[model samples]
Target chain A: MRLISLTAIAAITAFPLFAHADDRIEDALEARHGYMTMLAINMGTLAGMAKGEIEYDEAAASTAGANIEALGNYAVSDLFIEGTANGEVDDSDALPAIWENPDDFVQKFADLGEAAAGAGEAVKGGQANVGPVVQKLGGTCKVCHDDYRKKD
Target chain B: MAEDQARRVRIWDPALRAFHWLLALLVVANWLLGKFGPNIMTLHFWLGYSIVALLAFRLIWGIIGPESARFSSLFHHPRSVTGYLRDMVKREPSHWPGHNPLGALAVIAMLLVLIWQVGTGLIADPEDFVNVGPLANKVGSDIATKADAWHALGADLILIFVLMHIAAILFYRIWKNEDLIRPMLTGWKWVRRR
Candidate 1:
């Protein structure tokens, strides 16, 4: 009778855990994906100005830089919760390496924020400064993507 | 007296050794700047230019430097490379004053691939046209895009070659009891008496 009661309790707890797991994983995946998409859009604006393809409007560049900096400073760890890696969450491009090497992943994310802040400062310095900072910022994105994000 | 005379032989010249280490340092530093250093693209560009200049010097040195440093002295025919591998498998003693046949191939391969890497970098641009190469503006956007693709591909290839180079050095050290790294650093290798 004791064993039966214990088994009944285990089933009751395990079922709810399994039922909610998928929802939580999907929510985290969508949050991170949306965040990255926003970053890419702002990055595109800075890139255009840097390339001389778009006229160097100081205000526009500053706005884009600020946007990127704000996005980079977001609480990224909460968005990349456990079990949201590539196979675990549908539509997630995050590699399992991010979870396996959490400390390195966190460090790389911190680097992105720092680079973004530098880029924001560079935007006020005109074309020569903005161009290189944009490049440097892109490099930080590559560093994280290379190790933590899954390839298409 | 004979044993003492053969105890050490000059292999890599000072110029060659300097070139090897300086190039290695620049490559690693430039890679780090790209990956981690924001607001430092100016330094990255200067580093790339320096690498190009060093490579130019190496080319001329390969022609006129000491015999051991010359390409003609280092290169081997395919059959000779195969024979060297066979000898290696048989554990026969082979003491090359400079690079062995296989090492020669790696050196040449690295040089050629690096040439490709820098060449593409000269004409490429980062995404959305940011941080373009010096010559990128002169080329059409289509051509620059192509160069960008090749530049990325070349970077990966360089990484593979560098890893292979290190692994080979470690293998020689551990398996063949040859201290290849020390000779490169000191510009001298111990040769057995003939």
Candidate 2:
């Protein structure tokens, strides 16, 4: 009777495990899709400024800058979720080499995201030192892409 | 009857040849400048912009200029390029009126990659520390980041290929008695008389 009860308990516990599997896909999709939206908004606002449709001001610039900072978080969160789920989506721009060199890739992204966030803060402070902020973010992008992006 | 004849050939146009060599020199100078001092950054940026403009003009010219300048004429089948490579390895490289197969591919690849680098550079912002690509504001931070990565990689690749190209030319000159560089300078090649 004890063995029968234990086996029944195991079956019950496994039920939620199967249910969580479905949620993982939904979460992965959300994370990647969210980033895509963030990227679009970031570009749109910046382009508007460049075209003179939106005048540059501290308030407007800070909002754009903050958005840029948040962009990095999306990358980190999505990468983590996508990695854990290991979904069948191979169309991701991320190279397979990323998983192989997980430590380096993760570190690079973290460093890059930090730099980007720093730039956002700098922009928020209305810091005249936009050049430094730009450099930091640019450096991160260059380093990561050199190793990750496909050459074709 | 016995007769002797000499044939003179003209290949690269004056404008194109001049641009080619000058751009080569400027790219090297800019690379060195960046390595040596920050003072040259402004000049480097301007030179990069100039290269972009030159590439733009060349793209236009490729469609509308002389036959040799067209992309349609430049790119070749993989088989032909492989055959050229074989010939090159055998120390019997052939010369064409325009770019030879291997050289043509290299030229196109370099130009395309350089264009990408410059385009990205225009909008790349160092977050206002040292430099921002001229048009970086036109793109989002994410796009700019992606571009920055490509730009840096492209720059390094170009440098490597530039060195390889020079080495090949020198090898041809020494081993096959070819004057590859002279034609670009003088726009003339002296082959067999016909």
Question: Which one wins on DockQ?
Answer: 1
Off by over 4 Å in 1: A1-152, B1-7, B36-40, B90-93, B192-194
Docking class of 2: incorrect
Worst 10 contiguous positions by lDDT, candidate 1 chain B:
B88-97
The whole-model lDDT of each prediction reads: 0.79, 0.66
Which residue segments of model 2 deviate by more than 4 Å? Answer: A1-152, B1-6, B191-194
Residue range A1-152, candidate 1, lDDT tens digits: 99999999999989988889877877777878788878878887887777777888888888888898998788798889988888876777789998899999999888888888755667986876677768768877766765776543
lDDT of 1 by residue, B1-194 (tens): 76535367888889899999999999888777765665436687789899999899989999999988898967888998897787675342355567778888898999999899789889885533345688986887668867876886887887899889899877777777778888889988976643
In model 1, chain B matches the true chain B with a TM-score of: 0.89
Scored by TM against the true chain B, the candidates give: 0.89, 0.87
lDDT of 1 at B105: 89
Q: What is candidate 2's CA lDDT for residue A42?
A: 59
- Give the TM-scores of the predictions, in the order they appear: 0.60, 0.55
Kindly state the number of residue pairs that clash in model 2: 18
The TM-score measured for candidate 2 stands at 0.55
lDDT of 2: 0.66
